[model samples]
Target: MPIHSKLPDVGTSIFAVMSGLARETGAINLSQGFPNFDCPKPLKDLVYKHMIAGDNQYAPMPGVPALRQSLAQKYRRLHGCDIDPDTEITITAGATQALFTAITALVDRGQEVIIFEPAYDSYVPSIRLCGATPIPYKMQPPEYKVDWERVESMITPKTKMIIINTPHNPSGQVLLEEDLLALQGIALRHDLIFMFDEVYEHLIFDGIPHFSALRYPELYRKSVVVYSFGKTYHNTGWKMGYTIAPEELTREIRKVHQFNVFSVNTPIQHALADYVNNEEWYSALPGFYQEKRDLFVDILRQTRFEPVDCKGTYFQLASYRTISEEDDLSFAKRITREYGVACIPVSAFYVDKSDFKVVRFCFAKTPDVLEAAGERLIKI
Candidate 1:
């Protein structure tokens, strides 16, 4: 008998594989991009308080009204964009769910979805599951910047959407205003939907500004902006996120979202709403994360590995050429087993993994964990 699988090429994710290896080898696990610390006490207390106040139940199909409204206020305050929460926002289980829902809602069979590579792993699978084609345009390493000519060439009549992630994962590069403008040009010329995954929006470092697709009103009309609370709040296990789109686009996305997860945990939504509304808490995030990022980079400077300049995200990419000439995956495993440190190969995020020789380490860990990993890495 043959196995039935819609996603035949997909198997265990790199995060899971590296995590299992870390556990087996008793290595400092820096492969997956998750914080090794607890969320803010205020947010946690709010969650418990909401539970005590009997806010536990199914939220509305869209989301709790307070959360939706708060999200709207956040956009206005941060991005200088006005969004009608009642019509333009629909919360999902997480940004992962929101991405899938948007893809399913917007794409048709045989359509092409332009994706920047080495993209988040989930994007490809979601596009494939929607019966659409993933047209990947690679971003060169070191700089990890997009080539506008290549991107423009990839657009076609069948291209329905282009997915962009700023404060990019694994690469730790942030999309610039020029990059956004380039994408806006393509969208305007070709009439393609623009989707931005900005879960790491607030994690930018070194006084770098995050450019949002919402900054352009024309682009926003045809864009779906997805964000995750898990990334911002250090509560990845919570898995709560929402999308901001025009009313018509949101209506279609909600059709898929309404039946998929229906709604998120009611109390979690309410608590998150209160958290976002607090200006002081979210405002300090850049400074908070910058410290950890700088600490990890400083430690890497003492090692043979040359860490890339990371403008945003908790991840920092290190080139292992000075340490070994081995391919990235093999080098990652070698370090994990012999050095007692775990990191993800940059190739894991690429469509073709043969050429890349970098690995990603999560700097979201505590100073002690970073020091331990750094000690082992430098010794090697």
Candidate 2:
């Protein structure tokens, strides 16, 4: 018998593969970009309290009112943008759902969805599942900078959207204002939808400011910005995220979202709203994570592997060219088996790995975990 598959090319995610290997080998589980530490006690307590106070029912199709209002205020505070909480904000299960909904809502069969290579794994699958074509533009290794000319050239009449992630995963590269300007030009010229994934918006380090898609008022009408409480609140399991877009676009995305997850966890959403609205909590995040990033980098400085400068995200890219000539996947497996340290290979994110020799280390663990992993990595 033969079986059909919608995503025949897809398999278990690289994150899952590396994480399972880490578990079996007893390697420090640094392969996945989730926090090993617990979320804020205050946030968790609030959720429990809300549940105790009888707020466990399903929320509004879009999102809980309080949460949406708080999220709108957050956008205003952080990005100096005003979004209508009722019409322009829709919360989903997580940023993943938000991305899927946005893609499904906007993309049509054979339409091109341009994504930067070494991208988050979901982009390609989500685009393909929506019957859209994924046009990957590779970001060069060592310094994963965008090739604007190449990107501009990829924009054709069939191009329906461009997906961008700031504080980019695996590479930790942040999109600059210049990059945004170039993207704005391309989007305006081609009339393409701009989907920005900013789950790591608050995780930027080294005094680099996050560039929001909403910053460009010219492209605001065409942009859908997705953000998550999971990354910011250190609660990946919570899986609560929201998208900000123009009323018209959000309505369509919400249609997909309404049936997808229908609503996020109710009390949790309220708790996150409270947490984000607290100025002190959100304000201190940069310094809080920056210290962890620095400590991890400092520990790896003694290693043979050259750790790339991470401007943002808890993940760091390290070149293994000096350590071994082995390709990224093999090197990653070897490190897990021998060094007892788990990490993700950057090449897995690319369509082709002809010239890439890098792996990604997630530093979202405790200091001791980072130190232990760092010590083992140095010997490799």
Candidate 3:
């Protein structure tokens, strides 16, 4: 029997495709956004300690209390906003799940979700599965700046939510305070749910302060903020993340979350709770990633690819327009097979898979790995 497909167009993700091809061809993979290096040794040891101490059982549905409390303290200290760990935060498998859970809870059939173009791949599929319409507002390259006027004009009575990511993936554009203010205005006027993806919160660069929606009282009340422990702690495989919202919004998300992923990993939750308490661990991330970004960008300058200004995230976008006029998908695959370096096409992030002659490279690897990748890229 042919099963009906909700996401007929959604096949294997581009990240997986490129990474797979890189593996098959023995190419250096800069396609996926994960570090090639191991996480902090002490952090690993703590997880081992917890496992040995018999914390292998399932965690509480919302999360381990200790972990939630640690997160609450961090948010209070960083954002100056008090969050009730028990009521507001729910740990999930990853930011992806947290995002899907939020959308599942808020959007109904025929409701519209306004997502920016070159948006993350997961957003539209999640929205579609809920029978909601994804209304994309395309942001041009080079800047990918959000025009508040255009965003405001897209609003309608059926608009149920607006999803945004800062230190945006594929493109490394960070959201300014003005962007948040504009979103706040639109959300207030429409009484819409605001879903903020802040997984790359700590990965921002160049002295730019991360403007979290939790910073605004009104936005906080209406927003569901998703964050990744994997992104922060450099253990994407652990798949630990959480969502923060007002008590009421959280209640709805939790209703869906309980069944989706009743609980997160046990030992890791205990381990992360202990590790994150040290301020230096995450506080140093910006500078750490900035060094990697600088190394990668500096090396890429030797190539024909024109690098875009990367504000945050480990990913950097480079236009190959000068080198080839081919569409991004073909260009990405060809480079992986022929040039011995792999990257993601920026078009894969868009719903329509629009081409921009741009490709995204992940620079979260070691300097030597980036150097090797850079040398291969220079040949193209």
Candidate 4:
């Protein structure tokens, strides 16, 4: 008997494919969204310290109280939102888990979820696995701004949720206060649940403030906001993140969270609790990433590829139109095999594989790696 597939069309992630090709070809890999640097030594030490102290058993289904409390203080300091640690927060395996749990917990079969494309690869599949329809609103390149009126137009009785990403992956666009106001209005009118993917909150650049759904009272009540410690601390492999929702919403999310992941990494959560109190790393994140972005963009600007206006996030989109008329996947593969620098074709983010001749390069790498990739890229 043939095994039934939840996602019949889903295959390996494009990020994985490009990164693997880069490894095989001995090319500089900028296709995947991860830093070439290790996280702060102090954080690693903290994890070690806690583990050696023998706090290695299973964590509470909600999370360690200390980490949740630290996170609560963080919201107060950064966004001026007071969140109750005990009832409103739950540590997840990662932002993706937090996202999946929220979708599975709240959304019912046949319920519609509105997602923006080019979106993160996981969104549609997660919605599909839980038997919900993912309605993708295609956003064009350059600006990639959302039209609130258009979003409202897509709403039907079956519409249960609207998910959005800021400092968006593959686009580097951050949502502004106006965008939140529009979303707040629509979600209220339609009674739609909100899922805010703000894992790159601290990674935003050039003095643009991240307007988190947590900052808005009306939005927060009906929202499930996901964050990543990996994104913040340059340790994606840790797979540590959390969700902040209202007490009632969080309660429902934990129902699914308990059985799926149960709890996140224990020692790391302990380390993060102490680490977040300092705030030095997160405080200086914007400038740290800005320098890398400037170096990478400056280098690529000398070539035929045209860089888009990257306001936030470590990813940058450069249109390869001037160099090749080939589709983005072909261009990406050729560049990796021939030009020696790997990148993600933006078309892969879309369900329909909409091609704009644009490809995304990650700038989260160190100066040396960025310089090396830039040197090889300029030859093309």
TM-score of each: 0.98, 0.97, 0.98, 0.99
In candidate 1, what residue range of length 10 has the lowest lDDT sum?
348-357
**lDDT (tens digit, per residue) of candidate 3 on 35-129:** 88888999999999999999999899999999999999999999999999999999999999999999999899999999988998899999999
Ranked by lDDT, the better of candidates 2 and 3 is: 3
Which residue pairs clash within candidate 1?
Answer: none
* Model number with the top lDDT: 4
* lDDT per residue as tens, model 2, 43-106: 8899998999999999889988888899889889888998899999998888998999999999
Q: Where in model 2 is the C-alpha error above 4 Å?
A: 353-355
Sorted by TM-score, highest first, which candidate order results? 4, 3, 1, 2
Model 4, global lDDT: 0.93
User: Candidate 1: where is the Cα deviation over 4 Å?
Assistant: none
RMSD score of candidate 2 (Å): 1.2
Position 17, candidate 2: lDDT? 98
Candidate 4 structure quality by residue, lDDT tens digits, 119-218? 9988998999879999999988788888999999999999999999998987999999999999888867878899999999998888999899988998
Error of 1 at 193 (Å): 0.8
